[model samples]
Target: MSSVAARLAAWWHSGSRWPAVLLDAALIAVAGADLWFNRMPGNWWDDAVLVAGVLALAARRRFPLAVFIATLPMPLLMGQSAASLIALFTVACSTRNRWLLSACALVYAALTIAPWWGGSDILSESAWPVWGVYSLAPAGAAVLLGQLVQTKAELSRRLEEISEVREHEQALATQKVLAQERAHLAREMHDVVSHQVSLIAVRAGALQVSTEEAASKEAADTIRTLAARTLDELRYMVSVLRAGGGAGNGLAPQPTLDQLGELVDNAGMGAELEKGPLPELSPPVQRAIYRTVQEALTNARKHAPGAAVGVQLTQDDGAVLAEVVNTAPKRPAVPLPSAKHGLIGLKQRAELLGGAFEAGPTNTGGWRVALRVPLKSMS
Candidate 1:
């Protein structure tokens, strides 16, 4: 019975009122048929009360108490109407007000027993003792069934909400794990790779000063310069990983637009920098641009040694653009070990800033990497 009521409630809530209307009409038709077939002496007052009670059942969901009250007098005139049962059931299921529910149940029970108490010839006098019990049975059953349906609906809704919250929390946990992994990688690069690279640069610097051969001296100088630039890049990466955490003592401020000239000079390859009046950029954007150029130079040095690279930086209509293009290698390309994540990292950075990145082979058999980042201020 509870399940049937739940199905009916679900149908009603689905905005298809025609089914419920049809059911009510069918119930009224059946009640009229019962009266006609039984040859019950039907007067205009009983007919009127029956029709009115059935009509009031239509608005039971919106005004349960009112509908229930409207049907109360019908039972006294017309023996028990299906309309009254439906209205009572609706009131029990829709309202959580305990006082109102109890009052409605009591009223319905009293009405159900009224005819029996008034010595109607419908039942034998011996049945009068169980009148209250019989009258309250159906009403109690309806209320219990309605309460069950309501409890089930409430539980289903809460479970859905809990499932959604759990999914959201799971996504957040995954992101936190990824962030921690990035931080650990950054720490490893700083503590291990940077130290070795710096030592190499120190040794190369000593060799450059002490060596007399022009070729050896040039090679040593190149190594030392490249090492220093690598250290700078590692510092920037560490800062990014730490995400607002201080970079510790003796760390220089992150590179910006002003350092483009020095970056090209240190590349040891003939690289050109093209730019216009740069827009005021936040720290993250500046760092992204700087890193884009730095990674491009590093790739060129590794894959196309002696290539003439051009680095261009400009700002246009609320965006900062950086492009790096390197010509085909002038010397034999050196086969260097590659992690191949530089472009991937740059792509992630640009997207994170609500921008775009693209890298591919140029039409002239060269390579080009470009990044466009919005210049919106970060709050």
Candidate 2:
């Protein structure tokens, strides 16, 4: 029973033809009943006219004016009918022409009242106001009801359109935010993670080719295995980010100052670290310093192989300063593929933490990369 009610409600709300057809059926039944009870005795023609008016309502929605004209004969003979009233109401619901509506109401009223006006002393038998109410009341009510339904339907349609537009705009805003996050992640994975992994691969290749000691060769194999595993994990992470799906898997731990000593030691090149007592800093500041050092070490390896690189860290006046300086290579450097965005990425990262990054060639044909981070943001 509930399901049947739901379907009926849906049919009523939607633009289904069933509701209109049912309405016409009901009006026809009412008109037929009235004719059956009040038919003129021995008047076959009058009965036929009433039946024709009742049948005409089936086409009322498509041809409201024509159906009303067909039903007008019933009002002239019987003084009133459900068929004529239904036809007039349909016309009002389907159109908005004021002149046309006024004319239809006037004609229907005159026809409905014509039967009463035919007898002698009719004016004396019925008061003018009584006939006026009888003629106009039902017609006026039908027209008003039809106009209200039409207006309500129009308002409903507009609300649906507005709702759809808002949903579309929300989807666009969500996509825009996701796109920005994906771009930032792409830069981090490429600039920092990939660079470190490539260094591991390079060092492993060098050790495998140059070393003949069994244990050293095994260590090189272990490093390559570890590098490959790290790459596989990163590949999965990158795919998840691109597809915009995945539970947030906490990424591998971010780099920090504690890792700097190990980083410098395993750089596969000669480098020195000089620093005083390190100040406690926010995670972002620590990570920035670590990446700056990492990127500088990578550049020294690529452009100045066999060069001695120096890294110094100092804190003064509520700011941490980090600098990497390398001497001219003693031997020709190995060629490496470069995207050239390393310095630019470091600059962007520092600025995000209210810091600055600098990199340039030195006067002695060496290179220097430096970073300065203000501690005001952490405070």
Best by lDDT: 2
If scored against the real structure, what TM-score would every candidate get?
A: 0.54, 0.51
| lDDT string, candidate 2, 1-379, tens digits | 9999998899897888788778778888887887677655547888788889989988988898999999998888787777888888989888888888888888999988787785664576567778888889989988888888788866775465446445534544565466568867967886799789979978997998899999999999899889988987887777556534111332446678989999999886789999877668887788888879987987787678668999999986778889999999875554434556557768977887888888999999899999999878655
Cα lDDT over the full model 2: 0.80
Off by over 4 Å in 1: 1-46, 120-128, 239-379
Summed backbone clashes in each candidate are 0, 0
Q: Write the per-residue lDDT of candidate 1 for residues 110-203, one digit (tens) a residue.
A: 7766755646553676775577666677777778887887889777655654564455345445645666677888889989999999999999
Evaluated against the true structure, the overall lDDT of model 1 is 0.75
Q: What is the lDDT of residue 164 in candidate 2?
A: 44
